[model samples]
Target: MKQCWLDIRAAEGLKSVLCQEAIHRGFDAIVADDPADLAGLPPTVSRVLLPGKELPDAFGDADLVIVDPVQHGEPGRLAARHPGVRFGAHVDVTDADSLAVACASVTRDPVTVLRFADPTNIPLEIVLAAAADAHGLIVTTVERAADAPVFLGVLEHGPDGVMLAPSAPGEAGRLKDAVERRSPDLELTELTVTAITHAGMGERACVDTCTYLARDEGILVGSRAKALVLCVSETHPLPYMPTRPFRVNAGAIMSYTLADGEHTRYLSELRAGGTVLAVGADGRSRPVVVGRVKIETRPLLSIDAVAEGGEAVNVIVQDDWHVRILGPGGAVLNSTALQPGDRILGYLPRRERHVGYPIDELCYEQ
Candidate 1:
């Protein structure tokens, strides 16, 4: 998990409220400019003192102190003088020279706070690469809490932590939530096909995503919000057209597909930049961004399946051999070839949905 450090140095008026919110949200640390701000904070959060150019003679209740190496003496000497508080290095990378300094600090410092002068993440990437073998925590300072996810995903192994000066109390919680965004592995159930029927012409959605989905991966679609089936991507070979590895011929516009672990959205609600869960036949899943959604009138086919637990699921998709669904062990079963007694991979959500969000209530969908 990426650590979140709430910087409360500028929010002097709302310091108390922000600090309490940070503690409630389980922030890893709280950074303040003055040692006095760290006095009343508990040990649940690491109290961090990020002083100005001048080093303070005493660090009151701060568990860690971040300082510029050039402004203060060597961190080693300072640690020896003040053994109670942990010392960290802060580096501002503006040029090649400062980038080199930042890289070196990340390798040795127990905690390294980096602030890049520009918007590009190349400097942070290079520093991260330099610290590949180092056993230290690298925290990048982001301008806003919303930018934490981008910096946290840099080079796939982003900064070990992110520090942000939130504008309000709720921003800290949002930062924590963003850093903790991860798709959970689903326990997919084998759904035996009970019926297959041809439906009249309807608008079918082809979800075009920004990611190249794997052969075993696709989106889950169904007529009801409580159940979904794995609709394979366009990675397989087609008879007349070339494969578009980033697309899935999902289903009718009214069908529900998983937006994440806990939410579902109608096919019509998806748009560019929206997210959908790409699930693999093995039950592993990840969130993928929708680049575009193509809806066209096509002959529709409806499939009804039932799980061992007596839960029924239905999916309405384009009635064509080229459009496919995933079976056990990633078996690509063409929609036109599917018959009664066929088994396919599917997921059964435990709760009903209200406007895309999951909620427990009495609900039924025919």
Candidate 2:
């Protein structure tokens, strides 16, 4: 199982139901309910009150990002910016389909999410190789908004350390004094932040994907940011991430990208007899670009064709790193770094064969 950054959203009761579902399904939980607390949070399962502004600069790694439209106080425009994070705004209490669609929409972007999961429900620290989630902790003395100066006061207790000042006046002075007081034995650096949220020392509803050892195998969905695949060496009767948290290239293969050499979403067990395909699949019929490859750019575009609903009539195979069809498949393909301006075009697919345009003859923008 993977360690998940579960963002509990109240967009129509996702928060009300998310925690209970995770618990009933037996997951570690981290509850951050207030919006103010989320100001400088690192990725963790938190209930947020979205004011429609973007998440703070201090927000850290997160696979799942949920938003409740009510929290935003208007149309949920916040969903557009974080294309990589799964999305859902509260429509009503019975809107499971809408929630699922929102999750799918955001996770379809091209990026591999790191993961860790545990089958037995254990501590989050068990699977950390290094700092997988947090880069640094944002600590404060004041537990409430009124406590901002308290954070400054507490800092004074620490061992003498480097000082940083914000452009703001009162905040700068108080924080400096706090550090001088509680200074510990270790080095402490002072940074100014209006607020911060953290990974509470409690149940984390989800984990980084590798946190669990599973015996079974099934489709791993990157449909949600926090989605993960747990390998206990035995398959469980249910789905890997039942929440439908992320999106995959297809309904079958969940996807991920390489980060610092560890596998995520889908684990690379290195078992024998598996062929790693290098084809970069696309949704177009025109040749795709491989900016990191032999050429600088190439066109491999495809159109979504459906007899009825939204489904592609054909698929595109591009030679570019960003064939524009990025999704779950770092598992199937390997990446080769390209010098600037190098690119390639492998193949392209089309919705309907134009009377004059064969998949081979069609040309698209690079």
* lDDT (C-alpha, whole model) for all candidates: 0.92, 0.25
What residue runs in model 2 are displaced by over 4 Å at the alpha carbon?
A: 4-33, 39-65, 69-366
lDDT of 1: 0.92
171-239: candidate 1 lDDT, tens digit per residue: 888888888888999998899999999999999999999999999999999999988999999999988
Model 1 scores worst on lDDT over the 10 consecutive residues at 69-78
**Model 1, backbone clash pairs (residues 3+ apart or across chains), number:** 0
Go through the candidates in order and give the clash count of each: 0, 93
User: Candidate 1 — which residues are off by over 4 angstroms?
Assistant: 80-85, 238-241, 360-363
TM-score of candidate 1 versus the correct structure, residues matched by position: 0.91
Give the candidate number with the greatest lDDT.
Answer: 1
TM-score of 2: 0.17
Among the numbered candidates, top TM-score falls to 1
For each candidate, give its TM-score against the true structure: 0.91, 0.17
